[model samples]
Target: MYVAVKGGEKAISQAHKLLAKRRRGDTGLAELSVAQIREQLPLAVDRVMTEGSIHDPELAALAIKQAAGDLVEAIFLLRAYRTTLSRFYVSEAIDTGGMRVERRISATFKDLPGGQVLGSTFDYTHRLLDFRLLAEGDAETSSPTARDSEPEPEPEEEAGPMGRVLQMLEREGLLVPEQDDDQLPADITEVARSYPCDRSARLQSLVRGDEGFLLALAYSTQRGYGRNHPFAGEIRVGEVSLTLIPEELGFPVEIGTLQVTECEMINGFTRLPDGEVKFTRGYGLAFGQSERKSMAMALVDRALQADDYDEERSSPAQQEEFVLSHCDNVEASGFVSHLKLPHYVDFQSELELLRRLQSETDVAQPVEEQA
Candidate 1:
């Protein structure tokens, strides 16, 4: 025990030093710039921002570097830093209808007014690694293709203000009308409480929840646990403007725009008390090009709503307490890592008890007579 404790202390110290050295790489090599990470590794920054519940890309990039690229650690660092800031004002809820869309798609209807715009995506890319990337200065820069001598045909008709597909179903009495909530949303950061919370509070917790945990829970649902057959009614990726009302100004003003990913999931219908069948919906939104996270979140959100439909809640995904309690990577990391702390006192007591029990057992046993 003494050796283990001493060795662990030494090892931890050396490991930290080694990590710092590795993170910096060679003294002759140029240090990695935070700007590079923010620009080139945008998805990593997105994950940090989503889980950290913070909106600053620069800060997220720094956290990623400080944490040596461990996304969960970066998220924890960013979240911790967020608590130190002062709240100047709360922004008005964003209006997605006005989003300047870069990408939008619907699985429910391909022939929707706005034909699917497949933006920058890896969906059709072959998974082969380009060896040319290993060679420096191989990046090609080319100008946009020249327009034909003939005047460009009139641009495809812009889809009149893209409306939600689910809204159409609701209009036809095919889906339940959305519940109106006048109560202020519960802020999980301030409340720091357990489950049995409202949908607003639950969704607040879920947006910042661990992506892997949410993904696994969502996958379980697809495999028949808390199955809520879901169709991606719409997944939109774009920039949405934020507006904050300043007390001094006495009017709302645009702060800035934020890149975000939002998903609306349509689920199987259930019969109401009035014997009317209506479709259900789950919604998810997150920072920057986070399609998978949003989709997974939508699935889990619908799964956790099983109680509202009077469905069996036997699945882990459907149990609000179980899912919310274990989904924070920060909490899980601390609890799991705490086992490495010194437990000498506890071990000593157990060791003494074992010795006493063995002594008593030896005394109570008879010596072998014939041997």
Candidate 2:
């Protein structure tokens, strides 16, 4: 055991040195700059920003570099950094209705007030790799110039401030009524989470939850466990106006816009507080261009609201405690990784106990067997 422990310590040290060498790659090539990661790998940076719950691109880039491109590690780094910053003031909730849209689409509607704008997407692209990218200096000239081609402008109603589809349903008396705006919502970050949490707190936990875990849960719902037959009422990618009220100013002032991905999903049914059944909505919003994460969040959000529909809550996705408890990657990673730490004293105690039990058993054996 002593030899094994000493060997492990030496092995770990050597492995770390090798890892540092591997991370640095070739000495002939220039080291990758943080700015290059920020600019070239925007999607990856966006994911780090969204999952990390921090908005600074430069810091996210640094975390990405420090973690050697491990997104979860980067998120953990950023989240740790976020805890150290001094709190100044809280920003007001953003209005998605007033969003300056970059891309917007809906699966439920073939044609709406705003025509679908397919901007900067891989949706229709073939998944084939060019192979030309492997050749040095070939990537720059081989890039497609699709941006140079401009299509005709969409209709005024389609291009202009397109209203939310579900809001239209609400006006026409087809959707479930929303909660009163006057009530103060619970803050999950400020308060510790418990089972049967309120909607606001549930959503707060989910926004910082693991995207892959939420996606799996959302996918499970579609496969018939706690199925809600959801429709994408709107999946919007845009910049929303952020405003904050200063104590001295008395009135709210526009701080700056934040890029976000917002999804509004229309559930099949929900029983209202007044015992009336109506179509309900599930909402999700995330930092940066994280459409998939937002959509998954909305699906899981509705699944957690199964009690509202009086639906059978047998599925794992419908259980609030199970979902909320294991959804954080940081918590999961720490717990799993801690198993690698030395447990020599604990194991030694267990070994001694077994030896004592064996000795007692030998002494209790028959004299005939000893002969």
Candidate 3:
């Protein structure tokens, strides 16, 4: 007598059609274009690029529009697309010092060799809602800046291999010099023996990590979990060279360039094991202008670097394997969502236990009455 959901397929098809109509909204209005989404919702695009691990703003914007402004869904779309793409070649380590600087600032220093360029940022803007933006035909373009107002580029002075700012102070005998093992950084994928260790790969991972996870890890340091008085030494955003070492050509080849944001945090520290005092440093880098994430990442990076600083590592943020491995949004999302899938067998076992308990309670009630 139980005809088990015979129209399940029909119902699913009808539901999908209804969803499509709802998402499209009233057909009388002009549909949102990809270009409009790209220009209007840039912050969403930036988040998609950062969390999705894709650098193309246009593609990220498209994903955002397709996902109906759901940032996590946009990230998922980008991540899925990224997996399908083939790796042609690995680029060389970009020279951050030689970046075509767009935005640069330092909280630690008032005047650095490179004067700060506060490019396009929302930092100083008031948080009040702009009603004009919600209205059609109200958007206006500002006049372009005068060409003469541009600042001259810094001279091509080959700064010695961009050493840690703190390390420079340590060299003057003002701070403690941590022991340096001559061990070269292992080729990250050598254990698998497939991919090589390169700046591109490292940046790719950082940009795609969950924003909230990075923020939390960074906050832990300030909250006394790791305890570091971190000052944003410098935060820079610009484009850097991407080079490839071809198998046929032994020398590195200039493939192209990419925009990147780099953050360096200086921490106050009293050196131990040698009774020396010195400033320590932490570094973070990512693709695009993700200053918040980059800055947070820098703080977390510094806290994790405590092991190198000879400081006690008791915090979860200091654990490299734990932090780096679990910071991915895709992994977190999948693991969390997977729990919603059918667990009927497990539910049945729980139901049986509850029934047994109820039966035992009923039997005890009669025994209690007799007593």
Candidate 4:
């Protein structure tokens, strides 16, 4: 006997209640606080901030807690919240050269003027597990250092803006000279409305994009789709000034600053216009610490800028519009998930065709006998 199953609403309600209970598990332990998560789980916070397009560690921590530690869901939550925010003003381009660098390094050059500072990184740490930390009051905790032991340096007054490293290469005739243009660069918003082409805007979109999607696209390039040997010229993470120009004020105002990651990739190329061999550069920047993504983005950026590189077309990665437009995860997810909806009519049509084919095949009769 077949019976129609109902109570979908009841089942959904129960599931919600169960989820709530699971999220707030075990009353014995102290509940996870937003501040604690923000401070302790800073890497997670950085990922959320990078993908969320909003740089609030507290909010990201709250979203992470609310989403039950599902990083992707937390990103979605942050993105949704960002949509409700009103845009009061647009900030001027940040001077990254003047950043108060916490960590900076270059793969292209061993020594630079600022010098490489390997701040906090797990690169040198061993992967061995330490069971001592599992027990309460295990080993003697390290004593706190004196406040004046490493006093914070006062902010510099006359720090001259340094030109980009690639600019120096161009001057030395090692890199392809950047074409000079008298025309002013078009505004990003206006270009987005018509056709998105600005590298800054494209990079901004990729910064908040899904890590899985970005990683996959980057992986594809390495797997012979658009293979290009890339060298990380520089990778920097630090705080930069945010200056805003209010329409009414007609003067730049200093807004709150933010920490960001910037990457410059040098790629091999031979210029076509002059038939000269010179290095080409790709750029990537993102909010917070995301060196991997930024580096990958820079590689793809250079590949798409192949025309600018004067390299002969060979791969899909060289197609700027195709690569940039289809790399978004949200759009891909929606299109894929939409297939799960009820398509009774289409299913019925497919079923009829399959049945007809089966019936014709089932009728086993010799050709000679039939004739």
Work out the TM-score per prediction: 0.89, 0.87, 0.79, 0.80
Instruction: Tell me the lDDT of model 1 at 193.
Output: 56
Candidate 4: C-alpha lDDT: 0.74
Better of 1 and 3 by TM-score: 1
User: What C-alpha lDDT values do all the predictions have?
Assistant: 0.86, 0.85, 0.73, 0.74
Largest lDDT belongs to which candidate? 1
lDDT string for model 3 (1-371, tens) is 11223447988899888876876789999898889888877767777887887678899988987777778888999989988897776567688877887788778655455455678888898998989988977876675474646745653433223334444566787644546465443433233212222333333445567778888988988898888888887888888988889988899888778888889777876665677677776667777777888888777767666666677878987766676667788878888877776676777888999999988888879777567
Candidate 1 Cα errors over 4 Å, as ranges: 1-15, 140-159, 362-371
Off by over 4 Å in 3: 1-10, 13-15, 143-206, 249-251, 272-276, 365-371
Better of 2 and 3 by lDDT: 2
lDDT of 1 by residue, 1-371 (tens): 32245557788899999999988889897888999999978999999999999999999999999988999999999989998998889899887767888888899986665566666667778989877777976865454343624644433545567777777888999987776677798888888756577888779888999999999999999999989989999989999999999999999999899999999999999998899998888888999999899999999999988878889998999999898888988898978877777878888989999999988877777464223
Scored by lDDT, model 1 comes in at: 0.86
Any runs in candidate 2 off by more than 4 Å, and if so which? 1-19, 136-156, 271-275, 354-371
Best by TM-score: 1
lDDT (tens digit, per residue) of candidate 4 on 1-371: 12344568988899999998899899888899999899878888888888877889899999999989988778878878988888787688688888888677778876556566655666677967767767766854565454736844532422334346676788888886657464455543245513437665566666666666666666677777776777777888889998999999999988788888888888776655787678877777877777777877887777767666556657776666776666665555557766776666777888999998877766865464468
**Candidate 2 residues 327-349, lDDT tens each?**
98988898888777777888798
User: What are the per-model numbers of colliding residue pairs?
Assistant: 0, 0, 0, 0
**Candidate 3 minimal-lDDT segment of 10 residues:** 191-200
